[model samples]
Every structure is written in C-alpha cells, then in structure tokens.
Target chain A: MILSILAMAFREIRRHKMRSALTTLGIVIGVGSVVALVTVGEASSAKVRADMAAMGNNLLQVFPGSARRGPVRTLARPFQEEDALAIRREVGSLALVAPLATHSGVAVAGNSNHFTNVWGTTEDYVEARGFRIGRGRVFRDSEQGVAVCVLGNTVRDKLFGDRDPIGESVRIGSLSCQVIGTLQAKGANAWGSDQDDFILMPLRTVQRRLKGSRDVNSILVSVSRESAIPRVKSQIESLMRERRKIRPGQEADFFVHDMKEVAEAMQEVTGTMTALLGTIAAVSLLVGGIGIMNIMLVSVTERTREIGIRMAIGATAGEVLLQFLMEAVVLSLLGGLGGVLFGLAASLGMSAALGLPPVFVPWIIGVAFVFAAAVGVFFGFFPARKAAMLHPIEALRHE
Target chain B: MTPLISLRKVCRVYGAGETAVWALRDVDLEIDEGDFVAIMGPSGSGKSTCMNILGCLDTPTSGTYRFRGIDVGSLDRTQRALLRRHAIGFVFQGFQLLGRTTALENVELPLIYQRVPKRERRRRAMEMLDAVGLAGREHHTPAELSGGQQQRVAIARALVTRPSLLLADEPTGNLDSARKFEILDLLLRMNRERGVTVVMVTHEPEMGEQAARRIVFRDGRVESDERLRPLEARTA
Candidate 1:
C-alpha cells in the first residue's frame, strides 16, 4: 500500500515538474548553504591547526612580561641563558629549550647583500621550532661564542641565488660570519608572514656582537607529549616566577604562551562562525518549509475532486492523509539529496579556490538530510489533514 | 430474507434552527438483493442525498440505516468506510476518473486501497477493464479517452472489487443519446447476468423506465414507487 502511495506521489510530482522544482528550491538552497559553510569552516580550522603544527608541535614560549594588569602595562627584566637551563633541568616531560636573542642587520656575501633578521639561539633551536637542516649540519652546542650561522631559505636565496652558501663567509654588521648550513623552506606562519626569512646563530653570538648585553628576549620550549604540555607549562611558569623573585598570588614578571591554546582558540572561533552561518541557513530552510506547506495546501485544494473520487472508491481518511504526507516527504527528501550534492561541490570548489584543505564531516551531512525530512513532516501535516478531513459529497461536487 | 439495504424513517438536515434545510425527511426505503432500482427527482428533491446515504457516504440525522442486517447508523466513520470498501461501489456522472492517470491505474485504485498485492491487483484490474470492453485502451488517460470510454473506465473501477452493491449518481447525465443508452444497457446487463444489485439516480424518465423498480422523490419524501417488471423477467 505504501509503495503504491509513494508511486502515486511520484506521478503527481512528475505531472507538474516545474512547480515541484520551484517548490523545493527553498529547501535546496537552505541545505546547500548549511553544508557548504560547515564543510569550508572545518577545512579552514584544520588548515589553521596544520599551520600551528608547522610553527612547532607542543611548543611554548616564555616572554619577559605579564600580559596585562588592570589595563596598565609594565615591562619586566629580560630572561637570561640560565632561565632556559633552569627550565630544562626542572621541568619534567621537557623535550628541548632554546634561549632566543634577535638582531636585524645587513649581511654582505661577495657583493650580494640582503637585509635580514638574525636569530641567535643554540643548536636545539632546530628541533625546538620544527626547522630542518637543509644542506649542512647545525653548529655544535659548545660553539656558543663561535661566529658561525645558518642561513634561512629566503636569506640564502637572496645572498647566493641557488648557489651553495654552506662554507661561504658573510659580513654581518661588523663581524664576518661563516654560513655553516641553510634551513629548509617553511612557507608562511599563521599570520601569513614569511617564516623562512631569518638567519640562526648561537645565543652568545648575537648577545655579545649585536646587543652587547646578557639579556635573553624569549625562551622556546618543546614538550615531549601533547598531553604533558599543561603540566610542563605550569612548571616553567612557577620556576620563572620564583627565578624573577615574584611571590605567590602576585602578578608574575613573565608569561608562558602555549601554542596548543592558540590552535584550540582558532578552532573555537571557526566553529562559532560555522554554527552562526548554519543557523542562518536553517532559517531559510524554515522558509522553504513554508513554501512546501503553501504548495501542498494548493495541491489539496486543486485535487479535491480526486480526493473525493478516492474516498468514494473506498479509501479511508488515514489512507488519504498518508498519501499527501508521503508526497511532501518525498519532495523534501529529493531536495535534500540535491542540496547535499550541491553543497559537496560548492565546498570542494570553495576550498580548492581558497587554498584550504577540504574536510567533509559525515555527521553534518546526515543531520542536514534528516532535518529536511523533518521539515516536510512538520509543515506537511496541516495540508494532509485538510485533505483527509474533506467531505466526499462536497468535494465531488467541487467544479 | 433480509433486504440488502434498509433505511427506516431517515432524516438528514443541514444547518440549525430557523435556517435548517431538510435534505431527507421521513424517508423510508428498502432494496433486496439483485434488484435494479432507479431514484428519480429534480434538483433539491434529495435524490442525491438518498444515494449518498445508501452509499454510506453520509449518515442520517435521526433514523437508522442498515446494510446486510448490520446497523450502519451505529458505525463510526472508519467503519462506514470499511463497509463501503468491502460491499459498495460508486460511479459518478462526471466519471471522476483521475486525470493524468492511465485507465488501468484508475481501475486499480480500489484494489490498491484494499492492500491487494501488485500482480493480482493488476490482473484483476485488467479483467475488469476487459469486461467493460476497454481492454486495448488500458494505458490511455482520461484526457485521452472519449466521454463514453471514460465512463467505461469509471465503471470498470467501480466493479473491480466485485462489490455487492453499486450506487451510481446520474451515470448517464453527461452523455449523448446514443452513448446514454449504451451505458444504460451495460448497467442492466450487470444486474441481469451477474446478479449485482444496482441503485441509480437519474433525471431522464426514459432511463428510469428501464429499471425493475422506479422510486420518485418530491420535497424530500417518496411520492411514487412502481415495479415495471418482475425480477425474474430480466434474468429469463
């Protein structure tokens, strides 16, 4: 019986193809936009996480200042090389720690000079920040005072133009530094800034030659496991507070920034935006449901004689209701299927065009499909009841 | 033997109080098995209301209706529908064949509502269409068929369930004189050969004269009833 009723619904819909298509347009656009927005949003979040991983896996940084106290900023004393050593010694689950000092200068190599950033750190900087030695090896840990450097991909390209600069000597400010290696290319950071545009050297090299001070600007620390980052971060924070002579419950003179938190915050932001767009799209779906209801009502009115004929031929009110309800459900379901296909194509195209990794969440698709069918049920009920409640005599008499 | 249908002092009223319009007033009727009865009256004379009550499409406001010795007035809407589904068939003056549906599909509608299996329903619908002399036109839709052919399809649909009673409302009102007699002859043949009880409402006196018994209505009351021939005369 259900099969015949379904077949009857298909026949009726096919009879008025243009009207059926127009009726379902609302549902199609509603489900389509929701699916596309969610898919693209997930892809963007995943891309941000990937960029965070590229920055460094489970990496944290300690800067020499509290974030804010009563909206009045205060600058604290800089960290020292001993602070990095202290974190490495005291913090459990510690992977590596590198005290970083930075200086900007023009390096001249055989008349090809390039203004570049120079990062002064230990050999552990390569592992702590997820950089790989592209050509030559990193400097030894014992070579703290040695005037040796590793050129970043961009700096090497500017100075040597694809030529090997492993054993080349470059003049930096007033010192002649030999390039011992070149780091691999890392495209960009999360903020769309060039990441492979700096030169790396020993911490003492920049501190003595450029700054002429023993001040360390920042300390980079990597945790062995992602689950251990919070524990290690707290340990390093307390240790820094103690080292800087800050009492308990007092505003510390240092801040520990965890990269994992940054990644999670990025995900949360994208998720919120996706939900916002999905809700707006769902409103359109409700409007589309109204469209279906309106058309179903019109259909019931127009087919009054047909309904009367069926009633006279022994169809019960329940059977009549089921027939019309099935029609509405089938219409919305078809629209949902079309929307799914349209959304997949739209998301895939948008992700490809925007250079985001395409991500399709299966559960969202299932939910959208079910929600569309539910819309049909909710909106189709009144019209079906109207059809079923019709009087056979009056309906047959309808011209 | 108990009559196949009985209506005892039935009254069907519309609206209420001073505006009340009595469609059927103090009407009493009975129809035995295999009888061909024609109910004739002018518009507003309540012949249609009588047909509706007989078909179980409407119930009287005040009196009792029985079918096969079961009290129909006590039955609910669903039970009335069940009674109609299992025992009665209807043919309308407008034919009422669903537009855009094939003749075969229109004939199979009652069987579909009866939850008949697909193959058997199709076979039975085909046999009924063949019985109605529309065997080769099964796939033609109502719009594609002529007035006579559409009426034939409607009749095939009405009888596909092989119901015990067939109620037709102005079954020939829309046809030409030539087609009119053709349809009248078909109804008479079903009554005589298959012993199916047929109650029809018609306006034309010539049409009413062919029935074994003719009942005339005026102002919601039975005015005249005459038996034109014996029941065994048509069969013999």
Candidate 2:
C-alpha cells in the first residue's frame, strides 16, 4: 500500500517538475554549503597541526623578559650557559637543552652574498629545534670555539646554487667561517616566514668572536615526555628565578613557553571556527525546510479535488497523509543527494586550490543527509494533516 | 433475510438551535439485494444528502443506518472507510476523473487501495475498461477523452472492485442527450446482468423512470415512491 502511494507521489511530482525543483533548491544550497565549509575547515585544521608539529614536538622556549607585563617593555637579564645546564640537570624528563643567541648579518661566500640570521648555539640546538642535517656533519664540541657554521637549504641555494657548500668557507661580517653541514628543507612556518632561511653556528664562536658578550638570549629545551611538560616548565621557571636572585611572589624576569600549548590552542581555535560555520549553514537548512513546508501547503490546497477523489475511492485519511508525506521526503532526499555531490566537488576543488589535503568526513555527510530527510518530516506534517482532514463532500464540491 | 440497507427514522440536521436546517427528517428506507432504486428530487431537497448517507460518506444526526445488518452509524471513520472499500462504489457528476491520470490507472485505483497485486489489478482494470466499451482508449486522460468516454471510465472505476453496491450521483448530468442514454443504458445493463444493487440520484424524470423503482423527495420528506418495473421482468 505504501509502495503504491509512493509511486503515486512520484507521478504527482513528475507532473510538475519545475515547481518541485524550485521547491527543493533551498535544501540543495543549504546542504552543499554545510558540507563544503566543514570539509575545508577540517583540511585547514590538519594543515595547521602539521605545521605546528614541524616547529618542534614537546619543546619549550625560555626568553629573557615577560612580554605581557606592561606597555613599556624592559629587557631583563639574559640567560647564561649555566641556566641551560641547570634546566638539563635540575629538571626531570629532560631531552636536550641549548643556550641560543642570534645575530642578523650578511654572509659572503666567494662572489655570492645573502642576508640571514645566524643562530649561535651548541650541537643540541639542531636536535632541540627539530632540524635535520641533510649533507655534512654537525660541528663537534671541540669546534665550539672555532669558526664553523651549518647552512640552511635556502642559504645554500642563495650562495652556491646547486654547488656543495660542505667544507667551504663563508665570511660572516668579516669573520670567515667553514661550512660544516647543510640542513634539510622545511618550507615555511604558520606565520609565512621561511624557516630554512637561517644559518646555524657554534655558541662560543658567535658570542666571543662577534658579539663579545656571554649573554644567551633564549634557552631551547626539548622534553623527553609530553606529559611532563607542565611539571618541567614550572621547575625551570623557579630555577631561573632562583639563579637570577628573584624572590618569591615577585614578578619573574623570565617566562617559559611550550610549543604543545600553542599547538593545542591553535587546534581549539580552528575547531571553534568550524563549528561557527556549520551553525550558520544549519540555519540555512532550517530556512530550506520552511520553504518545503510552504510549497507543500500550497500543493495540498491545489490538489483538494484530487484528494477528495482518492477519499471517495476508499482511501483512509492515514493513506492520504502518507501519500503527501512521501512526496515531501522523496523531494528532500533528492536534494540531499544533489547537495552531497555538489559539496564533494566544491571541497575537492577548494582543497586543490589551497594546497591542503582533501578531507573526506563520511559521518558529516551521513548526518547532513539524514538531517535533510528529517527536515522534510518535520516540515511536511502540518500540510499532510491538513490534506488528510479535508472532508470528502466539501473537497469534492471544490472546483 | 435482512435487507442490504435499512434507514430507521433517520434525521440529518445542519447546525443547531433556531438556525438548524434539517436535510433529512424522520425518513425511513429499505433496499434489498440486487434492487435498482432511483432517488429523484429538486436541489436542496436532500436527495444528494440521502445518497451521501447511503454511500457511507455521511452519517445521520439521529436514528440508525444499517448496512448488511451492521449498524453503520456506530462505526468510526476508518471502519466506515473499510466498509466503503469492500462493499460500495461511487460515480459522481462532472465525471470526476483525476485530471492527468489515464483511464486505465483511474480504473485501477480502488483495486490499488484494496492491495491487489499489480498484474491482477491491471488485468481486472483492463477488463472493466473493455466492458465499458473503452478498450482502445484506456491510455487517454480525462482531458483527451470525450465527455461520454470520461463517464464510461468513471463507470469502469466504480465497478473495478466488483463492489456489492453502486451509487451514482448525476452520472449523466454532464453528457448531451445522445451520451446521456448511453450512460443510462450501461448502468441498466450492469444492474440486469451482474445483479449489482444500484442506487442513483438524478434530477431528470426520464432517467428516474428507467430504474426498477423510483423514490422522490421534497423538503426533507418523502413525496412519492413508485415501482416502474419488476426486477425479475427486466432480468428475464
């Protein structure tokens, strides 16, 4: 019986194909935007996570001053080599600690000259900062006092093009340094800055030879276990306060920043953004359902005489109701199918254009499809009931 | 044997209190199986209302209406619909066929409601259409068919379920004089050959005279009842 009713409904819809298509357009656009936006949002979030991971895993950085204190910035006392040593020895679950000092200068190798920031640190800096040596070896401890440097991939490309720079000499602001190795290419950070644009040098070589100061601007610490970061961070903070002779309850001169926290915060922000977009799309779906209801009511009114004929021919009110309801559900389901196809195409196209990985969220598609059908049911009931309640005598009398 | 239909002092009133308009007043009627009866009256004389009651489309405000020994007034809306589905068929004025549906589909409608299998339903509907002299015109919609052909399709639809009772209200009203007798002839043939009990309401005296028995109503009351011919005489 229901099958026959559904067949009748299909015929009815096919009779006025243009009106049915126009009625379902709202649902199509609603579902399409929802699918496309959510898929793109997921892809961008994944990209952000990957970029954060590339920065460093389970890593923390300690800077010399607190940037959050006041508008007028004051430079606190810089960290010493002992501060890094204290963090490695005093803090548990320690992986690697390197005292980092940086100086921006121009490096000239033969005829080629490139402007770059030179990072002055120990051998642990490469491991702490998650850098991979693609060519030659890292400088040893004995070479810390000697003038030696490792070139980033961009610096190699700029200075030597395709030539091998290992064991070659590069002059950093009048000091000629031997290039001991070259780091692999890491494209860019989230901030759009080229990560592979800096050169790595020994800590003592840059501090004593160039700057002539024993100040370490920042300390990079990589924790062995992710779960122990909060504990290790607090321990280092207190230790730094003690070494710098700061009393308890006084404003600390240094701050410990963790990469994991930044990564989690970024994920949360993207997740919220995705939800906001989805909610706006859902509102459009509601409007689409209203459109369906409006059209269904008009259909019921227009087919009053037809409904009367069916009733006179032994159709129960329930049967009439089912016939109209089936029409609505079928219409909405078709729209949902079309929307799914449109959304998949849009998301794929956007992903390719934005250079993000294609994210296929099957559950979201399922949810959107089911919700479209539910919109039909929720919106189709009143009109169907109205059609069913029509009196056979009055309806037949209706011209 | 119990009569196929019995109405005991039936009263159908519209509205209530001082403004009440009685459509049927203290009316008593009986129709046996295989009897052809014609109900004739002017407009607002309650002939249509009487047909509606007999077709199970309306119920009396007071008194009992019994169909095949069952109290029809005691049944709910769904039960009445069930009774109509298995026992009764209706044809209306204006040849009320669905606008876009073909003759074959219209005839198959009642069988579809009865949950008949598709192949058998098609066969039966085709047989009914053939019996109505519309064999080659089964695919034509109401708009495509002539007025006489449309009325024939309505007749086929009325008989598709092989119901026990057929009620036609002004079935020939929309046809021309030539087409009118054609529909009357078909109804007379169905009644005589199949022994199907038929009750028809008509405004034309000539249409009413052709029935085996005729009853006329006026101002919600029975005006006259006359036997035009014996049922056995026509069947013979």
RMSD of each: 2.0, 2.3
> Per-residue lDDT for A286 in model 1?
96
lDDT tens per residue, model 1, B130-186: 988898999999999999999999998988898989998999999999999989999
In model 2, how large is the Cα lDDT of residue B235? Answer: 48
How far residue A30's Cα lies from its native spot in candidate 2, in Å, is 0.9
Residue B95's lDDT in candidate 1: 96
* Alpha-carbon TM-score of each model against the true structure: 0.96, 0.95
**Per-residue lDDT of model 2, residues A279-311, tens digit only:** 887888888889889999999999999888888
**Which window of ten consecutive residues has the lowest lDDT sum in model 1 chain A?**
A65-74
> What DockQ do the predictions score, one after another?
0.83, 0.77
CA deviation > 4 Å runs, candidate 1: A66-74, B233-236
DockQ value for model 2: 0.77
lDDT of 1 by residue, A121-209 (tens): 99888988888889998998899989999998999999999789988999888988999999899887666889999989998988998
Q: Which runs in model 2 stand beyond 4 Å of their true positions?
A: A67-73, B233-236
The positional error of residue A348 in candidate 2, measured at the CA in angstroms, is 1.4
